[model samples]
Target: MNLWRRLSGRSRALALTSAGVLVAGGLVTLPVTAAQAATQCSVDYVTNDWPGGFTANLTIKNLGDPLSSWTLGFTFPNSGQKVVNGWSAIWSQSGQNVTAKNESYNGSLASGASTSIGFNGSWTSSNPKPTQFTLNGTVCNGGTPPTTAPPTTAPPTTAPPTTAPPTTAPPTSPPPGQKVDNPYAGAKGYVNPEWKAKAEGEPGGSRVSNNPTAVWLDRIAAINGTPNSSSNGSMGLRDHLDAALAQGAGYIQIVIYNLPGRDCAALASNGELGPNDLNRYKAEYIDPIAAIQGDAKYRNLRIINIIEIDSLPNLVTNTSGQAGGTAMCDTVKANGAYVNGVGYALAKLGALGNVYNYVDAAHHGWIGWDTNLVPTIQIIKQAATASGSTVRNVHGFIVNTANYSALTEPYIKITDQVNGQTVRQSKWIDWNQYVDELTFAQAFRQQAISNGFDSGIGMLIDTSRNGWGGTARPTGPGATTSVDTYVNGGRIDRRIHAGNWCNQSGAGLGERPRANPATGIDAYVWVKPPGESDGSSKEIPNNEGKGFDRMCDPTYTGNGRNGNSMSGALPNAPISGAWFSAQFQELMRNAYPPLS
Candidate 1:
């Protein structure tokens, strides 16, 4: 079977947040592929260790038909093995035998998709690898896959003599606190049905236009509402979390984006909060928000707090193209609101055991520029320090949050833009360099470790719209001269301009929320809800606290900054956080695995 068949059916396998237009919850699923023949997936495992403690990274491929749920089991040869913690699954071990089952947020699998799971373990004397593995009770092929392309010689694993009864235990509902002790076994994700109902109810929306009716329909939802004064200082955030718990959701993913001078480099997304209002940010913003998150009623629900988008990245690399050399972000940073505000929020929110905090590590485009990564490291460290806490208070950091950087840019080539150089084959990255989110994230994670962060700090990438699959992908690595085309089409992402942070065109839902796509990556989350507008492109008067940049103006596509006469603007989309009917249709249509 060929893995690239992008079409459903025996594809080799792997298997595998945010608001509205800002409760679109994180519990997301995608349109399913019709059942295909049973596929025997392959497993790739790696480990990094120090002393007795070690982290195991497993990439579980789905070779069979689409799986709604899955379970993985392996037995260590040595009795000294112990699973200390795990993420993305309900991990449990008995002696040397270990089992990891899918958690609520990540159960579905497309034919070609893969999901990841990881655990930390401690071993005495020697740590031996487990040779036998089974997924969903079916032992993995543990050999090279079969291919239609005739092999010149016999492919590996042609003769299989060994067999074992598949483990009978099926994927089960996670107990109220399955991994409370397992630092990595994480909280269950709660998708807000209210947002799902809203999306489905919208006029001319996805439910009416998308194909296949229903397969993985539950994954799409948005929480675009901001916490302006009318909302009682984040009462919206509180109420949504409450509703999630009411619906039996064990984990709630929340975005705290209303920062002062938000999105400073962009025309759109300027926040309602002022740059100088540190007092209000703390007293009215973080304090009350912390109260609700800290409340005993919500303690049962794991709160994944995504603190402030477009806040820190600006301090280092401001994408806004204000006519002046200085962007408003400079002002925001000067005021110290973005840094201090995030620090205070981290201190308050991280104090909760159930609340896992992820500060923003802007997408590669914004922060991956030359020296900006250093500043990102500095700023994150500053946030942790300002909070009067160590970096350990932060569960991890997130990348591409509310941004449209592709998960991987397979065709990015180094160019001296000032010298007018275009694409070249000098760089052929399989996604472990500066070109894509994956590499940037890996580098950032390593940099964090070097800078005194705990080894366990993980990452989350906002993949809501970075998929850009199928025909949308450019045909050649060095195909086009237009920089955007070169970077977007030839490369992985489809954004017209990296700085154009508004609702980007041709973007689609990326990898579903699975644990540990990469070593440091916790999960690929839809941090920005699909179907919501980045912000209004029309020159509409804004009473709401959101920013109104011409960048949103489909007609105003200047250089992607300052909403100038740049030529690559998307069509006029709806206001930020508003239900964007047409865009919603497009996202579902162009969905990576082909959403319904």
Candidate 2:
């Protein structure tokens, strides 16, 4: 994982006002008082839609008189379109009509002021944009009210739909050499020649050597290629891009990992910059990479950038006053470097039309709990909005990077019950909502949209090391004796605990990278190149800025994260990012869909 870690170094809306408008035999007055009438308003309705659902973001500008509050109104062209969940406003739908009332924090709409709000919605027959809108009771965009008023009955208050809508084909891919909805679709993934060579050197490695793996630009040196570096060899950013073009590859995946005070929660992957070195991160690391990526020579290639891994999540789970909190995480959080650095990277790289930025979201074991999930989403939102980056700059998100979370737990589910108890009550689940990477990624995407991300955002799951295959893989559900017995027996992930993230024994290569494998998943990516060490099993000195994390040691017991259990890491592993032949051999042997 260190090679992957440092490859170089390795690593809502609207206001409404209304003038008095008469329609449908009723006044249908504006929500504002007579003194304040929003005579002019504009509703910027934008949506990212798939087959049966979509995410709609609406920006309402009060172009007329100021108002104390506003109520934005619209009608779904297709009656089937419905708001499932929303944020930054009080969203309610009645028949074909939708209304969003400003929340307490954004109720004030001075003339010319604007606010944004959005929702995750579902559509059955067809999804079409609402052509007309109303602020308060006044028609927006200078249009007159419809002859028929929308249903006035209050919408029934209910929880968001828990089940996903029916899967429909995603919209058509964009034209060639342009940004497509799924970069992996109809694209040849850039296979890192260096990694391919290493795999070819291994016993029976040629079988999967050609599969694509990400090129890690883990440090400043990694940008130009780290000569004499232990793992990466001398291939830098341009070298890889040139190779991809030579290979006629359609897309290349690059991990933009170095952040000021990176990986604050763990010692194993600590980065080169200090907590306050954000300016240096911008000028030195990000600016140079952005310059190279913006090169017209690579314009035809879809460059996927996996933004900083393990940074933002620490702000939620590992900051002081939280469970599993760390002093390093607290410092990083207080300095506001991680959020700002990620935002800056996103803005800089994302400005290039060819670059698709996927920010790293930690695995389910770390932030799947209710206590951790929402806050993590909020922090990510904060970062996405910081440093001049908007949600549009973010192409999507990636999960399970450089980790071993199973892609899917077929035998065990959160709803499974044994005897009289549910799986959530089991030791393995620990009341977490998700049991696998796919569920967490999909759920997180929807939650992100509800929190105001672009609705079209897709999710990528790194399946490099999650395949818990071979004979150890569970064949079916466990016996019905007890919850723990059921979950533990049938689980595919053979780690001592979900918190065991270092180089673990029995881990294997997961599904081969593929595009649109699941509903909302853009691709199954090998972001964390397999065979790379997660961290040293013992303290072996190195200048990579990495440290000895006890969790990587097979003999070390766990921390609060793993419930104080034994570390499940394999013995005698090398330091983070260095290649390990034993780990590669194990991965091939245990590959879920077993290597051919």
Candidate 3:
């Protein structure tokens, strides 16, 4: 079947924390395609040793739907494997001959697919050999008799597969209590100061620059504190991660909050993991983060792992009941290891090692959802801390306040109240609204750092509706600005992922949006892209065409559905005039030379 048709029955995937707009307590169930036939699949994992005196393990699973949840586990072999560095999944080992275990997944896999998992372990001797393997229950190579006969005479093969794809070197998992720099570092881009003025010139534009503050940039280099590069897209080499990195950005007070995914809320409506999404995160989100960290490109990139807490633990059911079932408080105890198993998987793959985790502080209005914000944070924090990370290494947690509407007076007032009373630093980024991207960004940075943080705060936007490139119309009433003015400002801190890159895609590279040249914003990020369509195909049916309406079609309005349809489609549509991508690009390129 074709991609869309194949995905027809699939539900949209949810992030660990993607939630309803500003609601904290209620579960987030993102919209998705009607259910398709469930694919059939199974997995088997094995543990082995390497010549480097370390323990190793492997997982082989039939891709009944190209599953991405394959992870191998191994005992420490006497704690021999110290787990100095790793990735692909969270892991841990005990004993002198350290053994490792398989990690978990949160995305997708198609049918009739198979993937393997392996890790390096260290031993006191020149080389140590592992002697165990487990697949859910059945055993594979290490010595245990296979439950079933193999095609070959050998009961189990101890040797590495000759066709084994080159192992992706894992990143160093920081010792329990150290704070590593964020992944986005030295993101080479020019920050224009005259962005706001230029925005007004766009169709149905407002004086965005004149309002509060705006930040912009074009061609932001994805710096991971390592040598790895950003994932490529239809627009050539564009950095999706730069938006997240922009959050805790500044020369002296550098801090980083590694929040993955483009349209997490849109992704999470499904409330359960799909094979395709599970694999996507492994290959796209989590793995890429690990690779960058492993490469050590931006050593200064402080690592702060964020788990979006949109849906309840039990949104999806499994043999044990619904996955993540039970409240955060109850589940952690019952499934702490499994939860830790999840964390461990994340940790083993470079999650818990040095990176401290922060969960969604609140969903709607800082505690609006069914899941209690403060209480859930307490549970997740306790569970995460139980992993044995250091207090200093663990940074305080936070969440997006309001419905990406921090620019509104209500969000500002509430945030002002929280910061005034609490000594603890709390950060909430505004979804670039109003004309105050800089204002909120600067405030968040100060609060985060003052609370003993090493860096400032972040300001992320929801630009999928606008399609990042200058071609789309302004969905909101705020004015636009140049790239320069937006990036550098008195109160501005950093810019996290503003648009939904790849996911909830907008215009392609040729038609991508550009920041106003005069503003000189920090980075003109491709928050949205071509390949990954928005969760709800309602907006633009084929994921093609031009104009902001086509790019941000959450409401299927492009097909003529109006009113509430437009509610999800565009907040400020029926734009004054048609979108002119060429004009926008010309203005932006002149200011941001990399684009020029």
User: Cα RMSD to native, each candidate?
Assistant: 20.7, 17.6, 19.1
Candidate 3 weakest ten by summed lDDT? 1-10
Q: Give the per-residue lDDT digits (tens) of candidate 2, residues 1-596.
A: 00001000000112232333432212345443322332577766544455565556566777777889999888887879898755567789999999988776568998888775666577899876665577887667432223444456866899999999879954432322445688888899999998988899999999889999998887789988988777655799999999999999999999898998889878888888888898778767876676567554576798999999988999998877866889888888888899898888876666555678999999999899988888898999899888867677788999999999999999987887777688999888899999999999999998988998888889999999999999999999887788888898899999989998998899999999999999899999999888888888988888888889999988998888789999998888887777888999999999988887
Expressed as tens digits, the lDDT of each residue in 40-126 for candidate 1 is: 666655444445644465677775678899888889878888886555567899888999888665689777687656665678887
**What lDDT does the true structure give each of the candidates?**
0.59, 0.80, 0.29
Which candidate achieves the best TM-score against the true structure?
2
Q: State how far residue 478 of model 3 sits from its true place (Å).
A: 19
**Cα lDDT of model 3 by residue, 47-89, tens digit:** 2222332212233444233544443443443443466444445
Worst 10 residues of 2 by lDDT: 2-11
Candidate 2 residue spans exceeding 4 A from truth: 1-176
Q: Give the TM-score of candidate 3.
A: 0.35
Best by lDDT: 2
* TM-scores of the candidates in the order shown: 0.60, 0.71, 0.35
TM-score of 2: 0.71
Q: Rank by lDDT, descending?
A: 2, 1, 3
Provide the lDDT at 440 for model 3.
35
- Cα lDDT of candidate 2 equals 0.80
